[model samples]
Target chain A: MSVIKTFGKYRNLLGELVKKDIKLKYRNSYLGVIWTMLEPLLTMLVLTLVFSELLGKGTKDFPVYILTGRLLFSFYSNGTKAALKAVRNNAGMIKKVYVPKYMYPLASVLSGYVIFLISLVVLAVVAVVRGVYPTLQLFWIVVPLAQILLLTLGSGMLLSTMAVFFRDIEYLWGVALMLLMYTCAIFYKIDSVITGTNGWIFKYNPLYAIIVNFRNAVFGQAPDFQSMFYATAFGAVLMLFGTFVFYKQQDKFILYL
Target chain B: MSEMSAVTVQDLGVKFHLSEQKVDNLKEYVIRILKHQMRYKEFWALREVSFDIKKGERVAILGLNGAGKSTLLKVIAGVLKATEGKVTRSGVLVPLLELGAGFDQQYTGAENIYLYGAMLGYPKAFLREKFDEIVAFSELGEFIDVPVKNYSSGMRARLGFSIATLVEPEILILDEVLSVGDVKFRKKSENRIKEMFRQETTVLFVSHNLAQVRSLCTRALWLEKGRLVEDGPVEVVTEHFEKATTK
Candidate 1:
């Protein structure tokens, strides 16, 4: 109960931090927020050309598929990356002020989530261009959206805490994320590449589960309840575990910093 | 824990593990643990320290370098946790440990007011009401819109001081922040702190300036290498501290 009360008290600080992040992200850019909508659109175009034309793979709506997987993966990657550095980057403020330490990682993840949401507009446009329109299933997108957010928050908290103690985690995570991207099947269909029992390799990955469920919502298919349940449970458990570890180690952070 | 006490610190101790050789990365740390080479020397920054401050009293912490004065303030301000024992604070306490530490270099002075104010736990509506007052007090004038990276260190400190002092906290913790900006602004800040003193706010101040401590504090707590050596009236403690240090 007191935890909730503390969060309520610092809600405004969280808002300001999110705003500062988004503002600084586009500070000196000529096009500013226009880049948010443009970057994903261009990336979708490139991926679509590579997968559909040169490689002779994917359906006609492969562009939408790539955008869906790309955007979600980007958010997880970017959010966790920022959160990994959040505590160390704010060592000055941490030493001087008495804010709840979790606020730093929470703010970093939230700021990236905000930008990710804005970029979703690109997905919508590309989906329409490829003859895939919004359906009643679109509302079900919220499930996967929330799942990804929780998963990112969980990983972010855990990574940020580890990062304070071990600087090598930053470099290690970079290589890990690259490996994670390939496993997520961002460009290829999971069924086509991994057959038989090996399919569990992709199915077991929480991010892959989320991407599949999100694509279902985008393509007017019914939500995948099985994958949805698995991903949501995985995200929730990680989040709980992350919060536990973060709080346990937070008091010791000052000594390391 | 008395009704008259604004702050109570009981048997507070803070211990730090000093690694003989820095093992900052995970690989080195893992190898050291695996090889049974993990060695740690415990260093107590503050130990067996206890004190209570009555409401509205001004207390100065007097100590030499490495005497744990700053660590004591950090523990009291809740920035650092006590390794043993606890601190109980009854009112809204603000620690001005390092001004402008929260300011982002990319943000303008005006933007930083809201950012830093929010960081200090001020509500947005409250910051809006006091925005102009803060700008005027900072004397940044038109430079309020200029990015902090462009401001001189003095200007940044001036803006930080203005925002931090805007609200009269129930307990204000100051660590040598009175001497900010130029001579004129320093005097202005001192006067402003005096104004807060008139409101009967509790203050815990740490400074090397004995004369200033004598003027601002009614009582003093002198520390030596993490142990409290003297606690008495400001003048008496300062005299004793000076004589001992000069020997």
Candidate 2:
């Protein structure tokens, strides 16, 4: 609820750091900004070969499947990678500034969004080339994008702040993200997921609904309303908890830093 | 001392905790889920500290290293929350706790002034208009466009002191900032402090240099082992503090 104040207070700081992240990363690269596309494109190529050529036998629209999974991966993996180091990395800035401290995590979320924007453009161009026309339903992506952003923010907020107090949280988050890839429908369809008891685990994951909705919107399929609601509710709870921890311990950051 | 109490702190204290990083292993981190232990049985940083300063009273808090001077100043600034007691302030406070600690090293001196000004809650337009005055006060000359990391410690301190004094804070908190510059620049900072006092700004001065306090402050408090040992005329308290510590 206090997102306005939390966001507004650290906007400049976050904006500056995001600029630094982008600028610092691409400065020396030969490919430069193209790395954003090249990265996901390479992942899509590898997975498309293994999943589509080797195993996508009966599957229609294999490229869309791979593209959807790549989009989801771009957000979660890149988001968590930025988030895992967000606090430890910003030790210099955090020690001096009196910000909400969650701004560091929020910055990672925004950076991920920036990268996601790049991938979205790439996917759209490829989709057009493959004879998929833009649909009016495609406009509904704004909803899932906002939801996944909040969902990523919630998770990133928790990890980034905790990473300050407990340095090992970063490593743990790395492992968690690795395991989370399979849990989310990143490489395969959720319908092909395990049935019964084990299926409940995948069904409840926030990224599950997020990726499903994104695929649905961009591919003209209907979304899972129940899972989206679950993800939204859980994302809210995680965000609130993240904010609660951040606000409560925000001032103590000076001492820790 | 003036009639109005500009700042009051009653029985303030702070404690800290420490833990080994190994306790935060992956298995324990996951199992405990960061069930933090706030009490590691660490020593108290401050305990039962109390003092007050009236409007326009240049009260210096003098103490040795680790005497809780900085902690008390932080408590007053509200940068650090007190574990106990209340700090009542009559108006806005600008706590210059550590000179230049908040300035970015990569930014030029000019950019840092605005950044600090914004952090200190001064409007951008005000900083723009006051830009020359700040530059004149800093005396950094052509170096104003250079990053602070390239500046000497004295240059950094001068700019920090300049920006801090630029704001018209009703309560000014200075932590050993008087000795940062050359004799001429220090004199300038002293004059600025005098000007602030003239304007009814309550001054909470912290320093190891007793002479500055004797000249600038009317009342002085001596902190020993995080407790107020004496509070009175500047000369009397410094003498008492010197004698007690020298023993």
Candidate 3:
């Protein structure tokens, strides 16, 4: 009940912060928010050219497969990165104000999530061009979307807290994200390359699990409920743990800052 | 915890770790922990200081530099946590620690009013209703449409002061904010604060100017090196502070 009350009190502040982030993201750019749509489409085209045409890999409608993975991974990457810098970037305000410290990371991740949602229009356009039509299964996309959002928020909170104490976390996370991107199977088929025991690399990663479920929904196939349940549980547990750690260490943040 | 008290602080203490070599990286921290080489010099900014302010009391915190006056105000305003003891506040408290600290340079002065207001926990509708008043008080006029990055420091400070003083909070925390803008604007801002005093709002102020403190506050709390030296009527405490400083 107290949590709900706090949320109600800060809802307007959160909205303003998210709006500021989105507006500043493309402020000086020539095409502005148009980049949101064009970025994904251009990435899909480039990846298809390299993987399908040059490398002679992938099956039918490979562009659709790549688009789904790229969009989800980009959201996760961008959301967590924004969250990582949220606290330090707003150090001036943190030192002067009495706002809940968690609001910074929460707002940053949420702003990135909004931009990610907008970019999905490009995914839909590419899917139609690749002869993949939306069906009733698309309704299930909300499950994977929620799962990824929770995971990003959880990771963002944890990273933001750690980044305050250790500035190296910014550099470390950049390298770790590259490793995670490879493990997510964004442009590769797990069955074609790695078979048998080696498959656990992708299996154990919650982000990969979410991307698979998301692909299942977009490709008009029933999502794997068991995998969805596991991914959701993983995200929920991480989120709870992240929140606990963030709350405990938040008081010390001012001293460090 | 009196019913009439606006703020109650009990045995308040704040300790800061002054590390000889700042270990800001995870690897160094881990290595130090493993080698049992972790060392920190604990410096107490405030120790065993306690006070109570009743509603409508205007108290000036008088202290020399490095006297923990700002730390005490931060604790009362709920911006910093006390290392020991507790502070309880019963009303809406607004701390004007540094005005315009939350402004986004990329945004226009008009956009920043809402942003900074939101940061101060004011509702969007309230800002919209009083938008003209804030702009007029800021004297930004046509510059409201211009981005804040282009604003002069005085112009930025004026905008921040205008938005923050819009709502008459129950407890107003001021830290040298009255000295904002030009000489004329400073007088105007001080008058605005005097108006809030008329509303019976509790105020905790920190300033170096003894004349300003005597004119604006009824009581004074003097601190010397993180310890309270005196707490009494403004005239008596200021007199003591003046004598001690000259010696």
Candidate 4:
């Protein structure tokens, strides 16, 4: 089935799952929606402290750098991790109900977007406090960043589905992301890694471009257009191919699960 | 049986993969994969299970516990895939396979109308119109806004059954879920089932209650150890099921 049509088919179920995921995040917490801010806020503070005070890096507006890293990481980690279990976690629903199975993964991706909205508010406030002016160019950051989401979600669907068959992938993904943190220039300066051997790794890694794009757009700098182009094109293909794999393998999911 | 076949299954089968020990983490999974130590065991939850039912053909699947009756219905409902053979369902096959499997415990009963309504194949708009009706049926008036996990078993059953039976599926599959509710709620559920049955939905009902089976089903398929032991008029098949279990 075409990706567009399949999504078009499970639209209602997709929306419902997104609602459920969002509700679940704040469900039992006494502070409710406040916890959403607290995660990135606390993480940002700790990361700023380490990189500025401990590492002695040339840290100007440490909160800005920390928040930037956190926002992207939140979107990627939270999105990918949630989507990775989309099929296996909903086994009962999959076994009992006949939804377009790919809806489960897509919902996970969409749920991440919903949380990103929360993180966006927090990031904007931090940026304003740190004296970062809004660039009209920064608004354009949304385009490439959205592509990054597509790439992660599309690939995450395939990965999560396959993870059921090969259980080691989920664990492997965690370590891989840790490696990615260094390459994406999440904590450190992007220019420092833009040379020679480090340059080769950053140029090739899809997330490197995504982090650069976010820094440029949200933090008011220019992103590497070549990396963004590669990320966008690759993301489109992955969404198509990923949904296709999910469609083909969805029938066997209940049995395997 | 009515003239229109709403549910059909031919030579349907199921299999499972079994491992030597419990698989807890990545290390165990890697070892299992590397050693080729995972055993593929065909449990045959349903072996060559074939049946057909026209619209409004109330049928009961009678069997001992673990006789693969629920699996058969699930296959027909498009929930479980047949390892072999095919199942052609003419219309919406809502398998209330187990009570409240679709509801998220964290969501409110009101929220679950949309959630479970989606599961039963009804759109949000359609459920919205009948939201009040479902709530009234659940008898969870004040608690509709509260989390479902906090609800009593009976409350959960009411909520589950109400959402399940809200929309009429062309093929409805029930698997011993209604029996768990309180007597009053079960009576309510039975009435709702009877209403949908009267309206000519092909019903694949699975339960251990012989009287309910005889009263509700025009046909009966008796399954034993994943094999069909009898398929005929309810009187004959059910009598065989009773005798086999008693013996």
TM-score for each candidate, following the candidate numbering: 0.98, 0.84, 0.98, 0.90
Model 4 chain B worst lDDT window (10 residues): B16-25
Ranking by lDDT: 1, 3, 4, 2
After superposing candidate 1 on the true structure, give the runs of residues whose Cα lies further than 4 Å from its correct spot: none
Query: Which of the predicted structures, 2 or 3, would earn the higher DockQ when compared with the native?
Result: 3
Quality of candidate 1 docking, DockQ: 0.88
Name the lDDT value of residue A104 in candidate 3: 95
Comparison by lDDT, 1 against 2, better one: 1
Superior candidate under TM-score, 1 versus 4: 1
lDDT (tens digit, per residue) of candidate 2 on A1-257: 28685465445556655665665568679989998888777887788788878885425566766787668766877786687678777665454434456667777778778878877877887677666666777776777888888878877877776776677777777788887887887777767767766887677788877877787777876677887788789889988998787778766666665
**Which scores greater on TM-score, model 3 or model 4?**
3
| lDDT of residue B84 for candidate 3 | 98
Q: In model 3, what are the clashing residue pairs, if there are any?
A: none
Model 1 clash pairs are none
Candidate 1 chain A weakest ten by summed lDDT: A191-200
The residue-level lDDT of candidate 2 at B103 comes to 76
Model 4 scores a TM of: 0.90
Stretches of candidate 4 exceeding 4 Å from the true structure: A1-9, A53-56, A59-63, A166-168, A193-195, A219-223, B1-3, B20-26
* Residue B62 lDDT (model 1): 95
Candidate 4: how large is its RMSD? 2.8
